[model samples]
Target chain A: MDPDPTIAAIARWSGIAPPNEAARIGLADNAALITEIEAMRGTMGFEEEPSDFKAALRDCREPTP
Target chain B: MNAPVAVTDLASLSMTEAADAFATGEVAATALVEACLARIDAHDAVVNSVIRLDREAALEAAAAADAARAAGRPLGKLAGVPMMHKDMYYRAGRVSSCGSKIRRDFIPGVTATVLERLDAAGAIDMGTLNMAEFAQNPTGHNAHFGHCHNPWDPAYCTGGSSSGSGAGVAARFFYAALGSDTGGSIRLPATLCGVTGLKGTQTRVSRAGVMPLSFSCDNVGPLVRTARDAARFMAVTAGHDPRDPTSAREPVPDYEAALTGDIRGLRIAVCETFFLDGADAPVVAAFEAALDALRARGAVVTRISASSMRAINAYTAMVSRVEGAAIHANWMREHPGDYAIHLSARLFGGYAFPAHLYVEALSRRGPLLRQFVAEALTGHDIVATPTLKTRVPTLAETDIDADPANWSRFMAVSANTRPFNYLGLPTISIPCGFDDRGLPIGLQLAGRPFAEATVLKAADAFQRETGWHCKAPAL
Candidate 1:
């Protein structure tokens, strides 16, 4: 359940280490958030790409003359 | 040859009123600028809303505007209006500290497109206002320039990132200010400070030359006195910009003209779900009253179910944080110590999120948007909610930097507003009523994507029926 090691490892990979204990706590919370978001991935389709967001906005717009 | 308008009366005029007054030669631009300067000089110390006061440059611009009027030259829509902006909007060769210590002296070579548009509209830029550091935190807590105090009650928090823009507008220091909303930055302050704020659909406004927090979610908008003022501000600033290719090509309608104050048959949906969870009694009372007023204005209100909000909220945080982390990766590597402790910590966590998860969050955005629209706006012209789920908290209670334990209250300040950012919809916040503590409360209205006109029309109609927006702080 300790996210410190993973966070530290990722920090090293990203070229920035956690600056303090508060950062580690924040990272732990982020880890929880990521888990929650990942669980929702089942609702997404394999065909969808990040760029589809803009098209979605356009499609949902209220049509004007 | 007419007598000059009194400084107090000029300072109190809304942006649209000032513009109209100037157009008809009822007041000179110099007098308007001077009125704003006098208010800032007298009250800004208590509000702590101003970061820089460009008194000389503003007067020069005002004089030019007055001269143009005397010559009977053409004028822009917002001609002769005086305003300030959140310090993150860049002006060529002028310092835009972005409410951070690291960029305390960073000046950009290019002016923000919104500033250029505001200038072309003949609005005088008085100066820049305070904000959350790098426009990150939701609560108006800045360890660098000092937290922006609510004009209603200095002890209360001005919901931020757009802190000073909200406070300054409320205190009548200026008529309007540009505030960027990544995740409720503009709406939070608008609600907390009792002003009007609008965030068009994502990409509705250009971001070129402005500081970036989350590339996908960041929005450029205005904080003003009433929805009518917001409509005018948007008419000036919302449109495509060549410099910002991401800016939407959607035609910018005459937002002010759309404010006919006739909203008969407007279908407004109210979700009795996540947006209202754990709502404060006072907040609920004020929100219900606002709904009653809107109902009195011939708008149809319906209760709807929204089950996609939790996922929407989570994905929004993921995408914004990851993008923000990527933007600040270099600085975090070289000078993490330069940031406030809480900001640096938040950025540090951003670097830890897995890349796949980031992609997953973005990938789901389209599906989520479609679902939300179908569920919330399929039969509705607008979705209505209380801008904040709880009563306004004081600075002492929400300052996470002082005590990390304050994080929950701090984060909750933005809970109701953040989902709209992820939805990428056009949304607005207007003063609804005051809490038992005499602080302002707000009602948020959202509409279909690219429907800024619809949103403003509804808000303007509500303002006509109710006088909440007219009641200013005693500052």
Candidate 2:
């Protein structure tokens, strides 16, 4: 079993750069991050290449009409 | 009743008084500047708070502000009001250490957007205050430059990345100081050190020229003596900066005007769950007292379940770890030797995690925010809680090198406030009262997105009704 693959998976999905190779196991890369991303309740798997970017709203002041 | 050299608590002294004294053949900017510099000279050695100082440059700026007043051309809102920028903000020709040794000696030729505005307002920069390396840790401890000690109790921690900003203001070294809030950097310090600090909603203030922590979570604000002072500083710094790609095009509102009203009819939320759960006694008591006082003062207060906060950890776990890792990826790969052992190891391990977790974390955030907005704040104006569960932890307790529980305690106290950063809300941590040990515990007042005015008004009213902000460290 490749611990490195699991380590890479946690960093890719969770975004917290784990401390080192070993820390990816628990330290900064805890169990919550180790769980499969799609395993969470209703998340569709990667094969379902969903369309749009989860666009966040940016506040912009448009001139009054 | 006034001592001859009473260190003027810049929060207590009206800017007008300082300016008047300076102009009316009474006080000199050099005198005030020297006193502040003297503060850095005497106390900072023990506090170990200042990361960078330009003594010669500060003196020259003070003299210039004094001489400009003599020239009679009107100066800015904070004319001759000595101020310092948090180390995250780049000041050209100054080493703006983001508390990371990687850029420890790297000086910039460009000034941070907010620092430039503060300078334009005639505020003199004294130095760059210390923060957690990479603005990651909530504790004020920096392994490289040493930790920033709490002024209230030098043995304890001053909540961090903006730890020095909080400590500097609470110790009354400068009139005002700038800080960044990502995962509650500004507010944690304010709460720990007993000062007023603000965290603007996303893009409410410019982030240009400041080092990045979590791009989506980052905001620039102030730690000052009063919310009014924070507002005054925000008014000058919140305008659109062409240098910032994400900066809002909105006109900056007069935040000072937001402070003039009483919070008599405002609908404030008293959190029932996350903020209230697993709590410390004195902090809860002080927070309740503050809430009761607000109620007595005619503000309508209701206890609401803060389910939104539950999602905070998930959001933070998703965004910051990723962004923080991204910012340091190149550095982590190349000069891994530069990072403090704990931080480098932490970031390295964080980067090793699956990318899917990050995307899933992001996916969770949208729904989490929606639930929070619906359940916690339908018609509410703001949410309030003790800024931290407990008072400042002693260095013996919070030192990463000491006991493992210390680092755990440091992370636990910061958990309650990180949710607000994830949602990108404006929050102010104001000193409600001191603990039995005479150390300060803060009450965090957070409002809806773009509700900076409401939050400032509520904080200003609380300050008006209390004297906590008026108290300064004896040191």
lDDT of 1 by residue, B1-475 (tens): 1134444578888888898889999889999998889888899889999999999999999999999999999999899999999999999999999999999999899999999999999999989999999999988889999889999999999999899999999999999999999989999999999999999899999999999999888999999998888888898898999999999898888887888888888999998878899999999999999888888988999999888887787777778888999999999989988898888888988877778767777887888899899999998899999999999999999876677777678778888888899899999999999999999999999999999999999999999898888888998
- Kindly report which residue pairs in candidate 1 clash with one another: none
Name the best candidate (by DockQ): 1
Model 2 interface DockQ: 0.21
In model 2, which regions exceed 4 Å deviation? A1-29, A32-40, A43-65, B1-27, B363-367, B403-405
Residue B6's C-alpha lDDT in candidate 2? 41
TM-score, A chain, model 1: 0.57
Model 1: per-residue lDDT, tens digit, A1-65? 23558765765688788776667667667656757666766764343444588999999988554
Residues B1-475 of candidate 2 have per-residue lDDT tens digits of 1123344543345343454456554566777788788777878877777877878888998888878878887778777877776788987887877887887888988888888888888888888888888788888878888888999988888998798888988876777888888888899999989999999877788888888888878889999888877777888889678899787665777777777657778888887887877777888899999998788767999888864564455547667877787787777767777777557655654565457756755665545555566666666788888899876677667665444444456567687778887777778999999888888999899876666777888898888788888887877
Each prediction's TM-score against the native? 0.96, 0.88
TM-score of chain B of each: 0.98, 0.93
